[model samples]
Target: MTPRWYEEGEEPDYRFTLANERTFLAWLRTALALLAGAVALAQLVPAFSVAGVRTGLAVLLAVTGTVLAAFSYRRWAQVQRAMRHGRPLPMTWLPFVVGVVAALAGVAVVVVVLLHTR
Candidate 1:
């Protein structure tokens, strides 16, 4: 009988397998980096009256970063599984990411301007 596609007698698609693994690893690394940045922001702000805004922004960033990190692996896994099953890839989160980054940037700009004008 002809061997199944995934059987030992059949040659597996090494390139596809390797590419999926690499993509997953890249996403994981990105998640870790984001979480680390958030931790740094949350830790480095000092305690002061006017520091509240900074603290808030830092906290927001930390939370967003955490969310991104948490979602990265799950999304990656979903995509990998979809690819294996020959299904459509999951929709990209680029729009949400862009919106969040833009909002964060706006907040950061306001904070910086306020600090500078003081």
Candidate 2:
């Protein structure tokens, strides 16, 4: 089946297109923030009992953010292509994984702070 955009030779709304671009940039910015936070935590924290583990996790988060940033454009392109070609857009798993990791990280941070404060 032809895509709604191309089936009848309909042009995409420019306003919506611009909005999509803005949203993609926002995602990239969020990824950057996550990367910075991870790097700072890993590097600034002193060596302690769980320091190594926290540092390792922080590195992982930074890498994940980097990957997400790199892939953001690619994913946006895929969605655009799908819209233009009337094909299903590729599914994304990064967001779900990121969410889960963020939740776990929050729990870890709480545990660390509680222990440190006592």
Candidate 3:
């Protein structure tokens, strides 16, 4: 069944629709990378000095990736709707959130390594 929104708006330009699809694909790629990182971290990396820190970071990455992957489709739909309706594009904070989370993870990795080093 088609979504109500999909039925509401006229079809948007093919180019714009394709661009939105590409953007969605890019987000999925990022999500896949994050998920892969989580798996690699949990399986390949040695345990941190602090108990559960490694697991915690891995879970964080996995959750972030899951959320991003789920939301990317919503975002793509939104952009398509906006284009179809001739409305202004919607704004998003996803990039900022991803950046902050990634930065925090990087810092945590560094701190853990430093603290654990002999």
Measured by lDDT, the strongest candidate is: 3
Q: Judged by lDDT against the true structure, how good is candidate 2? A: 0.74
What is the Cα-based lDDT of residue 52 in candidate 3?
A: 92
The predicted structure with the larger TM-score, 1 or 2, is: 2
> Tens-digit lDDT track for model 3 on 4-113?
88877678889988999999999999999999999999999998898998999999999999999999989998898899888999998788878988998999989888
**Which residues of candidate 2, in runs, are more than 4 Å off?**
1-10, 86-90
Tell me the spans in candidate 1 whose CA falls farther than 4 Å from its real position. 1-12, 45-50, 106-110
Q: Report the backbone clash tally of model 3.
A: 0
Which predicted model would earn the best TM-score?
Answer: 3
Order of the predicted models by lDDT, top scorer first: 3, 2, 1
Error of 3 at 81 (Å): 0.2
The local distance difference test score of each candidate is 0.63, 0.74, 0.91
- Name model 3 segments beyond 4 Å from true: none
All candidates: TM-score: 0.63, 0.76, 0.90
Q: Model 3: clashing residue pairs?
A: none
RMSD of 1: 5.9
The pairs that clash in candidate 1 are none
Between candidates 1 and 3, name the one with more favorable lDDT.
3
